[model samples]
Target: MSEVQVVRGEMQPWTDRTSPRPALAALLTDVVPANRRTLILGPHAPQLIESVLAHSADVTILVRSVADAQQLGEDFGPCLQVIAGALDGLQTPPYDVVIASDGLDRVLGYDSADLSWSERLAAVAALAAPDAVVVLGLENEFSLLNLLDSRPAAERHGDDEWRPLHDDPSRPVSVEQLRTALPWTAEVYADFASRTYVRADVAANARPGEFPTRLAVAALEQTDVPLLSPAHEGVDTAARAGLLGSIPTGWLAVIGAQPSHDIYTETADTVLTADQNLTGWDTTISGEPVPATELSFDPGVVPATVSAGVSVESVLFRLASAEDVPGFRKLAADLGDWVTESRVVLRWDDVVYDGESFAHGVSGWVTEEPVEKEDLLAAAWVRFHERLVGQHRRHPWPPWMLGDDLVSAWLGMSGVEAPEQTPATSPDTPPATSEQVARGKEIARALDEVLGTATGTVDVRTALAEAEAAKHELFELKGHVYGLERTLGFRNKAMKTRENRIRELRGQLQKVTAAHERIRGSRTYAVSRVIFHAAQVRKPKVVARKISRKIDRKIRKR
Candidate 1:
């Protein structure tokens, strides 16, 4: 059985919580020399140790934690020699293959001398034979992941960061600096959490539709951190500007042995590798080839060459951001036609154009069931709407138009009406009822929650600013409404006063007309009218002569 050797300054009651990295294990399949003396400098995943053992029988692992060393000794039995001590205490022959993929930060124990990053790197190199292959992993302090991280400073710098020596001047920050610092020829890979690794130079020269760009984007999108911003957006922007390699989360440097593949990616069950030709990927599970039909999800199905062209979603983003309604509608119509003809339910981001026709860039998620064309279209558009709004992507659409309304508008633009009951079902099942559609949407939302795509926390500053603006707008609207109501009330009162006066005048005129008609209808008034007419008709001269004669006779008698 193997034995644990305790040297000077061993850390007690400590365990390195590093998890297994499948991509790193796959990389070791190519780096570890067969039957050669190998040394592992820090605590790594057990799977990686097993991989090293698979290649070389003579192996030794040095870890600062005594418990970890003892556990390693027990686990491997006679296959491994475990050393529990600080790096400075280890006294052994130079190894032909030295691997420090976990970095140098954890190699020094609490009781050991305070060493700078460069000094520790030099010590690791010193332990390597003249022609030894050294594999090193270095985390970047200024990586995009760290920049976009939304966690508090205290939470980010935990107990594990006791002596980070971040301000050391001799430490390498970039790939160029790292290459220059290494004594031997080395190949550097832009490592993304050990899930994906791409050649540094290739990633630096990536463009929007290229394989490197796609790989970088896919890797960045898999983050589960509460990011201040979307990681994929930053990756896309960096790739477009030809600066992707400059901001990788970490770097893996391999010296003495060259990697056969330019790219390495690890899924849950498989490792995918692509050579410089970039024609296709070679997929394996634990160094054994697996059939394509056995795989459930294949992330390595990106375009083989630049000729495959850009994704439809990319074009849609451009048009929507530019607020070119006409252009967006035209493209939507074309996409609708393609979907109708092909009857394939693929995501807009997965559908690419090859100058003449649309094609699926990734194929594993295509729907196998027969679904109505409109329903399929609605589902795709609805998903797009969710991502567009959830990611806070700018678009021409109004802010108030959301949920089904926004999805309907998008479907309308695509020359297909939105389904009344839209389903968000898996590719294998076709939705049949409204209940099913509702359940499907719920499942989709749940999936988003599981994936951490919907960050529940809003930016406190931005939310407060928006709330203040909305409150001010509502207050002004209320004041304007109050003024209009007051004016309307006064006008209504004046109109009622005029209406009452008109009614009073009409009553007085009716009384006067009744009195005149009564006088005209009375008998006395009729006789008086008859006498007046008689006097007018008689001769007034005869009456006056009779009166004068009578008056002259009276005067003679007197």
Candidate 2:
């Protein structure tokens, strides 16, 4: 369908149903899916029980519940609301038109909820009978709408790296929020607020005092009832009842740190002027009938006939805090449809605002370049590794792989070679020397790393040499330690024998220690990123045979 009709500003005697998205019903009529089962087929679908009731009833129905769905005179049709736990066997398809409305979107869009969006949708979808139509509604631009339309609001910015700003002072509940919060079309209860900011020194700081600086003959407005001008500041009790001096009207409320007025005031409602132009539009939130009880966004009324200059017309409700970055960014997104290039300014305390409006003097401050994402991940990884090493050094499994034997089986690092392996001992026997255990651990770590990074052709003899001396402890095959898990007889006895061998190793250790002394002295621990040779366990026998032949040839030559 073409865009629906849209209405703007205060209601004019002349009405235009001409536009595609009528500003009033823009969202409900077109935005939502008009399927058979709007909500059941989706969380947004209307209730089957309510849908059935609305289809055949002329009664002023009150489908009482959370965010009650009531049709006073049936201007449209039906509505529904199924609270989370109250949905007794919700899968039983009840309604033909299920409208999930905008509420479900809030659950899905931002925070982390128990059930994901799709999960919720699936539950609702399964409820549908065959061919049941499910229509779900979500505010595509949720945050933006509030900036341009909501009343009192707040937003947060630069609160923290993770949670910078929240509860923005600028973002107001949007007309949609109002519709969902209250029970009316946003336009029915509101007006497009146009104000020329009245700066004490400069031209209007915000707006509303756009035209007419002071009173000449104050514009008189009457809604059959006397419509007082909101501007004049004279203390005339006599004029107070019937005559309000020189204030232009058309503001519902104002909310800020030191608001010009109270949270709400009545003198802002639309009063008919002699010229028939809209004036003094004090918005009434709680259904107050009199101007005395009427609340406004700002406190004081505007004066009549002020100087006119650069004029700006914008959406009526902007209750968002200018300081809330995410919220305002959301609002900027909503208002983006109504305003030009939207942005959210966040103050990173001990930090600067980074922006791009320098040409307009609307630029920002930049203290430093933002941190990169990779740096964050790297930092997290290092911290995790350190924590694991600290807490699990004695574990036979490497701290890095965590519990994933498959993945841990392939982790590697540079700059470390296997230390010579000693032997292991059981508790029934004397505990093995710390030196022996340390050597085995070092070799194990090195072997794991080599497997993880090894490449190219296999070198057999070197592979056998690098194998652990405790190999028998893990293998049925002697002299070799395969990467397989769970060996049978090899563990206990082999470890004992290896321990015995190390005990007998006392004499050989001196020679080995002499070689180690020289080797340890020259140890430069620098890593060479060279490709290591792959180990082919079987080929060691072949290579050994060739070595023996070369040795015999060398002996004959000698």
The lDDT per prediction is 0.74, 0.26
- Give lDDT: candidate 1, residue 169: 80
Top-lDDT candidate index: 1
lDDT of model 1 at residue 198? 90
Question: Local error of candidate 2 at 557, Å?
Answer: 99
> What is candidate 1's CA lDDT for residue 258?
88
lDDT of 2 by residue, 51-72 (tens): 3333322211112121222221
Candidate 2 accuracy as TM-score: 0.19
Best by TM-score, which number? 1
* TM-score to true structure, per model: 0.73, 0.19
Over 298-417, each residue of candidate 1 has an lDDT whose tens digit, in order, gives 343433432346777778888889999899898888877877633344466657665567766533332334456666666667667776776667898888887767766776777764
Q: State the weakest 10-residue window (summed lDDT) of model 2.
A: 358-367
